[model samples]
Target: MANPMKIRAAVKDGVTEVKVLMSHEMETGQRKDSSGNLVPAHFITELTVVWNGKTVLDAQFGPAVSKNPYLAFKFKGGAKGDKVVVTWKDNKGDSRTDEAAIA
Candidate 1:
């Protein structure tokens, strides 16, 4: 299992801002390892963010993304105490889901 994601959500002036820090190796197959062998590509392929059961952000990531990615986004119509959920699926079939309440 991977490390738990760090999520922070806050609402201000009817806009909710969410920040997330995802933990992943994000290895690209083109890279060479210590043994001079090509490393298998492993990176988050899809990501989604939902607030109050409504989709707020849906994105796709590729090998170009850096390891331990950090994302920040804003959406309208979220209130305090509402839930913000984030989910990501990697190319290797591994996935992670986490949530936070709006402050």
Candidate 2:
């Protein structure tokens, strides 16, 4: 299992901003190890963000993304007490979900 994600959310002027930090190796399958063996592809392929049970952001990523990726975005219609959830699934079938309340 991968490490838990770190999420932060805040609302201002009726808009909510979210930031996420995910921990993963994000191997591209093309890199060679010290033993001259190719590394298998391991990366987050799907990411979803939901605000108050409504999908706000959906994304698809590839192995090209850097390890321990950082994501940030903004959306409308959120309040200080609303819940914001972030979920991600990697190519290896590993998945994690984390939530935060708007500050």
* Highest-lDDT candidate: 1
By summed lDDT, the worst window of 10 consecutive residues in model 1 runs over 73-82
Clashing pairs in 1: none
lDDT measured at residue 36 in model 1 versus the true structure, 0 to 100: 100
List residue ranges in candidate 2 displaced over 4 A: none
lDDT of 1 by residue, 1-103 (tens): 6899999999999988899999999998899989999999999999999987899999999999999999998888888899999999999999999999899
Query: For model 2, how does the per-residue alpha-carbon lDDT over 1-103 read when each residue is reduced to its tens digit?
Result: 8888889999889888999999989999999999999988899999999987799999999988999999999998899888899999998899999889899
Quote each prediction's TM-score.
0.97, 0.97
Q: Give the Cα error of residue 10 in candidate 1, in Å.
A: 0.4
CA lDDT scores, all candidates in order: 0.94, 0.92
